[model samples]
Target: MSYTPPSWSPPGQRPPGPGPRSRRDRGLTALAVGLTLLVVAVTGAGWYGYGPGAGDERTRAADAKESAAPESTAPPSTGAASPRPSLRTPRPVRAPSAQELAAARRPGEAAAWIAADPTDLPRRNIRVDGPWTVGGTVVQALYREVTAYRLSDGAEVWNLTLPTPVCEAPEHAAPDGRIVLALASSGSRRGARCDRFQMVDLRTGKAGWTKELLRDPARDTPAIIVHTAISGDTLAVAEGLGAAAFRVSDGSRLFTVPTENPGRCHPDRVAGGSRLLVSATCALGDDPRTRYSQLRALDPRTGAVRWRHRTPAGRRVERVISVDPVVYTSIDNERLTDDWRIVALGPRGELRRTIDPRPKGFEHCVNVGIGAGLQPCPGVVVGHGLVHVGGTDRAGAYDLATGKLLWGVRAHDGRTLTPVGFRSSRGTVVYESATPSRPGRTFVLGEGGAGKEETLMNHPAAAAEAEYSTMAGRVLQAGGRIVVMPSFVTGEDDRRQPRLVSFAPAPE
Candidate 1:
């Protein structure tokens, strides 16, 4: 006899609207009902009281069914847990010996070696400054620690943990490689922010000293660390409220100069070249329209002012780019006109010459963000015994001695080229191109009036999609290397992973 499962009808309903059911059918239906009632009673008893194996068989059957189902076609989740960071102490970095240093300093050898063997150091926070070279080592600021690595081999040299997270990137190392300065701030509650000035030795990676610079609980504004420069034994720091000079040997205050108006007169630059030039803006009165610029050359040894130069009324000095016997200043008044003037100052803070370097039919210049703030772009860069002026529509190079235009290039097809830096030793000028059709291109203008363009993507050490800005002090050239720190992007997922890439200069 064939065993068949049965279906039951309600008491008042007909039996499936058919003839009378058979005896086998009636027996199967009663068995099914009895089994269902038994299951319900067992499940209810297990849920209410306790049963060791109650529902285990049913759960196993359900799990087996789920396991045999087809796989999903959607992509894997990116939210998977990341590997934990190592908590063990970092291995000690091997220092270069005297013989290694001598071999690494040979002409053209260091760059070629570094190019062939590129070093990549993973960073945690991308808001801080990129890597900087001091002597033969590259110093980088990691999460809460600053690490030094050998430039040639990428070996860890030494590391120092900061008391708090770094607020700003480390400033450029002095020409002689004495000290590195940076600003660090502790996490604040309410409005109280604690800021400190930290200095470290370039050779040994040892911290020299740290000083408390600003602590204000009432004001919610962040600490503005404007400029940091080291010359001889003196270190100068310029902030929003004022500028101060400190002795590097010990964290002692040398001299302080408070701005005339903190809101109006902001510190521009602290050039520690031949002289310490602390330039700031001084508003004539409450109105921002009547603001004029002031330059005070201070003695590096003492905080005494060497000389003071004030611009005429209605003019403001936007930037002080370079100070090598000649002080190059960028002056403009956007309220009155759209043109900008490149004013050259002598060592004595006397106005030398003002050259208007605007294109004929250009409309207005745009502000490009650099570092922690925004500054007007298409400005001037002074180097290689020449003054390179950039504008919205065109760029030109002028002789530094005579102020005569040497060569000019105009934008074509909505593409703009701006001078990024000048290789004075090689007698070649480097410009970055902004073209929508292709990736960024680097154009090198030679002394013979020839321009060669190369796509940055093709460059071995360049970033994936590299770009440059006309911000005065963004590019750093040291130790036969060009270090570019681009403006940081915003948004949670859109931010670029901050990286400092070193490239060998283009062949002359």
Candidate 2:
């Protein structure tokens, strides 16, 4: 028996009376409506799934996990972090007053003096130790001794003599101003070995410790002390055959690194920075036609070899200059070839790049000069993110990082420019005229070669004829203040003496 199905109705409307409509047809219509509703709901969900905020919650969860992780333990690179704070005393900030200037300029008077035998006066650069505050007095090194003097009157507060004559300038005082290391010998000639290494108290001028390194008594040649450096409580001394490290506090030996073959590889020079120690070894044998040079970096704390770089046979590393994570070295062939190259190396002894500093169109520009002799050829100064090469007729600056030439400038008024020093900020370079007769024209050129030429001294005599010595060793700066040693004290005169003169910048 077929039973009549209940009829469906719209909301608020009466149901249609059952007639010819079949129940199967009504059931199929209801099923289709239900499926359409399901499809609409899914489409709505799909649109919301791809919206902008859909993945935000998941991203935040990942970020939270990263934030809760542990910190890294490795030391930061020089580019990644600021340098460790220096322990050395901050430079003295007191600018000389008008009255102090007048007193300093007197012919016979000076800010201070060592008053030792004339033979004992530091013929080389005098090592200035401290304006350290000790018992309310500022104390500094005075060549053969440590002396405390009044800045106002140049009067002596206390004085202490070194154990032996200084072979070279004393190693720079320790960063913390606790101790100072000096290499001492019985005589001054190159053959005179610096057998005694002495540490002096920076504050009290008291002797801390003295250690005499063992030496080969049978050796006849002069003892070659290649380099001496002080950094972070360690003292490193490099010589002809080997390099050694010692604790600066008690003079205890740390470690020594010797050359593999003294006949082939002779260690010539060494340099140190805040973190790394570098040494250069040159090859010397019967074959003068070709030579080899090697450079090695050692752990400053332990004398472990970190890395070694060797030049191609027939070339040698002439000099090494370390400026922390970066090292600048000069390379040349055995015959002293005309073309010389300067190589820059990274902290790991990786080669960064090489630079040629010779002037344009000059074939024999290899006479670069440094130190007291003042030979021909230009000088090279590296600092302030720039490499400055000074030639007799021209000078130029190169980008320190990339070795790209930045600017080249011709000498003004037919005077050759020589770099004396760079300003602490590295934005300005100080140049002295090569013409000794051109006085009153110390040029201060800006880094980018765009600033006005600023004169350091405005005298009328030629540089050589000037009453005072204007050489690099004579012209000194401490915290922006300039000091000029007397010509007599600088040995410009026949008799070398001790005197200090401070100068203020001439008016514009």
Candidate 3:
């Protein structure tokens, strides 16, 4: 039950334990040192060598768990109470017709499809977040609504709905697509309480500013578990009782969180781009040796803090990974063992090198779950200044000035790499591999991380088992296409298990 309704707390706040949970068994149960991820594949291999071929699967059909309404014998005997049986809503699990997904494509592979849930299952575990591919469209949120699709043929274009249940989002959307959801003020599928938020416009589903979170309802206490970050136009937001900012083009407000800190430290979580970090902790008056967990540096328009950095009394700040030359991902259990590092900061924060992706089998800095904020690594990828580490090996890089480890890219015969972004102004380093055989490709490296990698697209072996299931943060790759899906969806699964698979490249 890990969609974490109140439990997703372990990425950073550990005076004792519990945090970072919700690979979703249905939601709720997170907070502190519960990391738990073993993803093993950025998108390819191991789920059983990529299910290797699984007897060619393709029967798929699990979605109906209801359709009952016929039982009135006792009422019949009583002669009157027998007149109430009207239930029937089980017909949602069909998606597969972009011309039968282009006749099950297989030529150099790249026209596969799927991403059509039509809604119908929910007794628990809904919280599906995004795939978020701006403008030409590709968003997703599901629960309170926010669909988008249409990256050429995925279709559906525009949904937006919300009134509750969306819990949190913010990975890429203000460059004009404008998003910033975070609902869940209370609808309890398992507890609810993300305080509240709105502001939409994924290229026009339109809905602008709606609020609810409190900055001081006497002293504020709503936020059950929230985390956001936008940067540039400032959006910030952290929860439990600290950190706030807004004004990403009209939400206004721009600064809050300051009931009194400095050593009282509270901040909860934030990590916008260009720079806006924050992740305080302080531990107040319990003294497990003064608790400690800093990494501030606000000022995303006056939330002003500037620089604090602290993290050596018990060490915490877990997972941020890139905020204008300030990477993150720390954790230090001490005597119980379990160290994990990745640091990197340096723009005025200090500490420019720590990296220890577990000696290189790379944990992608503890994976994270449920809309994880700061920056969910998903096989990491911070610009060419260096710091790239796909799900595991076969695609490494690090050296944000000297955290060293400079290179690792082998997959020509291995076929399962995973790195994912970067390529403008010649930054290079974009990768992907997935394999069931004969499809799923993406390459490009040469430039600082070191020369020659190039490939571009192949994607088709009938869509490599729906592009090897999901997760490399559910994979993206906008307009040119690469979709694949599942950040959350739990009616139970097994109806062939591939809800949103895209591939594209066959069109042109």
Model 3 residue 483 CA deviation in Å: 4.7
User: Residue by residue across 396-495, what tens digits does model 3's lDDT show?
Assistant: 6666776766555543332335555676634444546443222346766554343456666665554454444432335666666667665545454433
RMSD of 3: 23.7
* Candidate 3 residue-pair clash tally: 27
Q: Comparing candidate 1 with candidate 3, which one achieves the higher TM-score? A: 1
Order the candidate numbers by TM-score, best to worst: 1, 2, 3
Q: What does the lDDT come to for candidate 2?
A: 0.44
Best lDDT among the predictions, by candidate number: 3
Alpha carbon lDDT of residue 336, candidate 3? 15
lDDT of 2 at 346: 68
User: What do the candidate models score in CA lDDT, each in turn?
Assistant: 0.45, 0.44, 0.57
- Comparing 2 with 3 on TM-score, the higher-scoring candidate is 2
User: How well is each residue in 126-204 modelled by candidate 2, as lDDT tens digits?
Assistant: 3333334444334555445666544334456677887554543323456655554445455343334556677776666
TM-score on alpha carbons, each prediction: 0.60, 0.59, 0.33
Q: Return whichever of 2 and 3 wins on lDDT.
A: 3
